[model samples]
Target chain A: MSSNPQLRRAVTPWGSFSWGYSDVGADIFIGLGLVLAYAAGASNFAFLFAGLVYVCIGLAYTELAAAYPVAGGGQYFVLRGLGDLFGFIAGWAVLLDFTIDITLFAWSSVDYMSQLLPAVLASVHPWSHFLVVLGLIGLLCLLNVIGVRESTAFQGSVAAVDVLSETLILCFGFLFAFQPQILIHTMHVSWPSMFGLMQGTSLAIVSFVGLESISQAAQETQRPASVIPRTSVVLILTILIYAVGYSNLALGMQMWHPVHDAHGHAIAFWQLFPGNGDNQGKAVALLSAQIPYYGLLAQFYVPILGAILLLISANSGVFGSSRIAYSMSTSKLLPSVFQRIHARFRTPAASILTFCGLAVVVLIFAALPQLDHGARAVYQRLFHGEDGITFLGDLYAFGAATSYSFVFVALVALRLFDPMTPRKFKIPFNIPMRVRGERVEFPIIAVIGFIGIFSILVFTLITHDIGRVAGPGWLILGVFLYFLYRRNKKLPLFRSQPHDWRTAQTSILKNAGELELMDEYHANLRASDERKRALR
Target chain B: MIRLRTGFYFLYVALGTIILVRVLSFGVRFETITGIVLGILLIALGIYRLFQVTRVRTSKR
Candidate 1:
């Protein structure tokens, strides 16, 4: 790692700290937090805990990211900090994270649109909405290929809109029209319902997923060490933001009950206004649910505007994953094809297009006639009552949880094993009954990361509507995929071998002491870079 | 490349703010004591990780 510490910078750090912050946004999971807060019937405590888990993990990653701050977030970290096998698992887990990150947003975006265009979208006739979603994806991809400036400019604008719209909504939400009675009545504490909190963790986890940008953005930032430290601070800020917004959203929905688990915490948001909530004025009903609990005119159109802003924010989530992938590709972990720079636009065209394309597929399925169609009926029944889009998102969340567990373990293990490695930045902690110089103890952050992720994963494993068969089944598929990738490529059987006492004492340290580790590693990498440039 | 960086930054944040504001505002009677405890726990954890830095790095694996 010392030999090639800056490899990530070449692929990731765009330039400096300014560039890192300016470029990065939260991930698809954040979007999931919004949708899931409602989906899980999240109350203030639920969102708070869920949000805390996210920010806490973000803090873990924040420190790890500063230490490693490579292209692959958890995957890259595990490989280096742990071993190759766990690294492989981390990589596979990220695939789950990336794929579902794209799919979930695409589906939810389509769902939002369905309310606006029911006949064309909800009727499932010609499936015109599907095509439109696909086309829109293609356009995003094209734009990604066309130029970075275009992509960033558009996402930034919509991001601003997201912040602004929500601010108005929250202000209205906590205002006079907010009747505390309804929320107080619904605040039921049950062990059974805490399962909802576990399920909701998936949503909360979703919001923090985008913090990968901290690693991805390290390349572009002016000061990797300084900026990385601040990213943790920003994560704390983000938690406050999510906790408040989601809690009030739940409170705002006191006027009505959701369609059971069908509506979840999202129903809380949908319940802002008092009315029949019939399917007919559903769009108006959905929008009306947003009638600000504040002033007279505030109730008129603020919710509608906020919804629009959220949908726009969803698009940026797609953009976030695409950009990260592009950076990865350029680093050579992903195919060079994904690394293709729009000759004119100076952006990774192929990666962006792929992201947009997949999103449209999800949108089409989520919106329009198909979900209600007979085949769709059977499919939904076979899976459960929910559409594939939603379940798939849950599956994504499950994969995300499992994968995150690996990260926490890796962090703790690394702290135990490599107790005193040099890193550009460090997180602070204090320990009880410890030596004077050492106020804090080892793996404290690691312990926090482990506890939070483990508790959530335990809850997720137990309580969710995830198919008992499907959840583990997905992991089976992942294992099979790993084996297949291995057998075919003859890559490695022990994806990661345990480093025993002798191995760690001798081989590992011997290798670590290699005189020209960085020089050799970078030289080899530069050769590959030349080859790529030649091909280009 | 540039768009993914700077443009998307504002774009994504602009989008996230809605979720952020909403989540934060949903009033809950939080156990303030609990929160303070958690915050302190985090600070302690932070300081601990920093301490590991000053330890003996040249020690054998």
Candidate 2:
């Protein structure tokens, strides 16, 4: 951190991994509830499908992050590789996801805690779920503005506990309570149509969305070229196993029973979980309490732990968005106001306040259905009754799919344009392509990743009625703002400066801080020179 | 020096083995397959590390 609100390279490999892990916090707790609502017993397969794409996207990010090693994550990669216009688009899309991350995680944190504390649950009554979620977002925003550092130790501890607890629950639940035959039968019996499965898979992409934090910390990581690859592999595996395993386990437990009213009339679970259109985000707590030996642990520990982890994630989102906004401001992609630091706290107060304000706007649209007659019916009809959390998931999926597709493309462009730049690690299975007297290796993994993620984007458009409208609206507005910024700066909006590997190399070298690492690199270069001399 | 190095290696192996045995025996009774698999992986890694330590020692000699 700097007085001017710049990112610093202080994160170790484990710290980087913990940051990614914790930012993804309790996604399973919320994800299981959402995916099950759509795909029913086939939720496991949905997660499995999304998890496969996540693996591709994760590897693609690792390759890009290692090569560029910048703070803006995908935004910087796309900027250097593609150009400023596309870069702004990518950064703006990610901003959308980060804002949603802040609000959604905060809302779900209270939703999880409400299972334990009746008082917090009661707050959902008066002004609807709006007041509580807004309060949490405001609290997180204020914390960020005041420059409260989220301790890496706290992140690591929470990540370790969550992983261990979930692993235990999965293993015991699978061994004792999970019936493979029953899971298979349920998958068959409640198996959705292809259309339904597609929708569920698109939504399931939300579970792995926050893993991009690993790459976002690339500039902050020690030995990022090696560290990102190591940390991201473990990060991907952890999320993959949990997402797929939990979905199957939830289905096995038959946790999707329809809610019954006080008079015992059957109502849909999604309808009355919060009655006035909010999601039942505490389904994971309830599901855990149903697990045999884990029931007691789930009753006391799960709700509280789940709440803390979600709040941590919400806090990370605020930090992530402000940092990205700061980086963009430095690049001249955003208004210079976003770059302004608080005189007292040395934090990006402008970016924090603006993004939180945007989140508050989204919360209002989500609660539109709770309004009086004319507007209520209109909102329901237009957005299709998507609660705030579910609405956030829709936009998250959209943002993830959009930015990831661009990143995959950026990976290919960087490989082609900067062919001589040293890549410590490359995505597996590259095919050589000769263009303009230069041989560039095109990654087969990135190609597949682009296709898979693009398809998810398309399906997300087709399936999420609200996201299809709102997501494009956000991008169009971003494009409009980008052009305005370019015109004001007297810079070309569409055209960009020619690709220069020297500039890219300079960025990498400027960010490289470790003496031992520099020593090792120089030694390796010297050895290469010696080998050439010997051959001559 | 060789004795001290080998002692640390042996200690590492012993710790890993204890984890392995506990996970296999107790984890099975508790029906946690994840613990058993994770424990076995740790033990294999420990043994590999031990071999590397001894190999380095012998080569130095």
Please report the candidate that would top lDDT against the real structure.
2
What are the TM-scores, per candidate, against the unseen true structure? 0.66, 0.83
Give the DockQ of candidate 1.
0.05
Tens-digit lDDT string for candidate 1 (A236-318):
55344544444444443433323433545444443332222112112222423444443344334433333333333344445
Query: What iRMS does model 1 reach?
Result: 9.0
Query: Candidate 2, A527: how far from true, in Å?
Result: 15
Lowest lDDT block of 10, candidate 2 chain A: A268-277
lDDT for position A16 in model 2: 88
Q: Model 1 chain A: which ten-residue window has the lowest total lDDT?
A: A1-10
Q: Summarize candidate 2's per-residue lDDT along B35-56 as a digit string, tens digits.
A: 3333443345446546756887
A345-384 per-residue lDDT for model 2 (tens digits) = 7778888999999888877776555544576677678876
Please give the lDDT score at residue A13 for candidate 1.
28
Model 2 residue-pair collision total: 0
Compute the lDDT of residue A439 as modeled in candidate 2: 62
